[model samples]
Target: MLLPRIIPVLLHTKEGLIKTENFSNPKYIGDPLNAVRIFNEKKVDELIFLDIEASKLKREPHYELIKKIASECNMPLTYGGGINSVSQIENIIKLGVEKISINSSAISTPELITQAADRFGRQSIVVTIDIKLSGLFRKSYKIFDHKTKTTSNIELLTHLKKIQELGAGEIVINSFDKDGTMLGYDYNLIDYIKPSIKVPLTALGGASKLSDMTNLFKKYGLIGAAAGSIFVFKGKYRAVLIQYPSNKEKKLLYSLPYFIS
Candidate 1:
């Protein structure tokens, strides 16, 4: 039986590794390399490192730093931020990275998605959509533009269908409101968006415990549990700690029924 992949979504700025609440107030956590080493030891399913400043500053991905991280990672690594061109995607893949996540570029210049997919194959290209709901009823999908520091009015389901047509291998649906909240995965958002796209989908933000992951997979079918705060912080005080599920914990998690219906 297929198992839902559990992934840790690590964020880094120019300063180093950090965490954020609702995509604001980034708090420094620890060294990126150190976290990768620990994840390697824990045998994580996969890892995602996103440079929060890359798109805001309009700079290329830090290839050297990515190379360093990829070298230490025992599992597949996916890197995002400032990835605007096909050449950059090729370079990142050359550094032993398995996937390249495109966000802002995918919105502004969507052709880059198709271009990169053609050059590197669709499986190597992932699109991450940061979303925020508008108004009390949450009727519309607001696409968060990190570079502009504003949200765009786009229909969530329509945008996702376009992404699939663009040949993206996977889709990461990130919640702008729930990021770093550690509340739980947004089940309503998953249900709303899942039927539109056929590709592998991953949910990030608001994942506080292993049971949250179990619940997501059991109901959602094949999906990825990508989290930040829960993996790095512990207890009420939220102390910084690098951790992952033990081998036994992982065995039980993967063994859960992946499809409920």
Candidate 2:
């Protein structure tokens, strides 16, 4: 079995890196470049820097900041947010980003995925789905629209399959309900969406610790284990503490049996 890549998911705004709860209530964390420098020393497997405000503001990614982060980062980086065109993808690649994640744009214009994949190769394209479960039993998928600033009525699995068909190399399932809760990931959501696409899938949001990642990887066999709060904060108070598991801890995590009994 292929070991899943352990990734630190960092949120970006005009201010800098921040953490959020349920995708709202933003709390300032630290500088993005400072975080990158720390992660570089830790030798993290990969990094995900998402510009949370870019899509909502309908602006291109902060290219200068991204370039700075990429230049300082030693590990492979995956950037998402405000990417809506082929030129943006080309430029991000030129800046040394290993992958480009398209969320709102993927839902708004799926052909962008195909176009990007055709030009940059499917392996470089990652589609992110920010979904929420609502109503009785909390069992429906809600697609949040950055353009309309509302939840879209689009069906969940249909969009997942569409992203796959468009030739994305990977899919990142980010949970709106679980964002920053750090209770755990939405396992039911993963189980529901697993069979719909063939590409590697990564789970994001609500991962508070290493075991959460290990359990998800063991249960779903994901290609990437990504989290934000667990790496950026410490303790129940959510104090600012950017940390990553040491190399020894990561090795132990990957060696665990497929099923922990």
lDDT of 2 by residue, 99-124 (tens): 99999889778999999999999999
Relative to the true structure, candidate 1 has a C-alpha RMSD (angstroms) of 2.2
TM-score for each model:
0.95, 0.95
The parts of candidate 2 lying over 4 Å away from their true place are: 136-138, 146-149, 257-261
What digit string (tens of lDDT, one per residue) describes model 1 on residues 1-261?
445789999999989999999898988899999999999989999999999899888787888999999999999899999988888888889999999999988878999989998888999999999988667665665788877767876667878899889989999999988899988887778888888879988999888878788877777774799999988998988899988999899888767754322
Candidate 2 deviation (Cα RMSD): 1.8
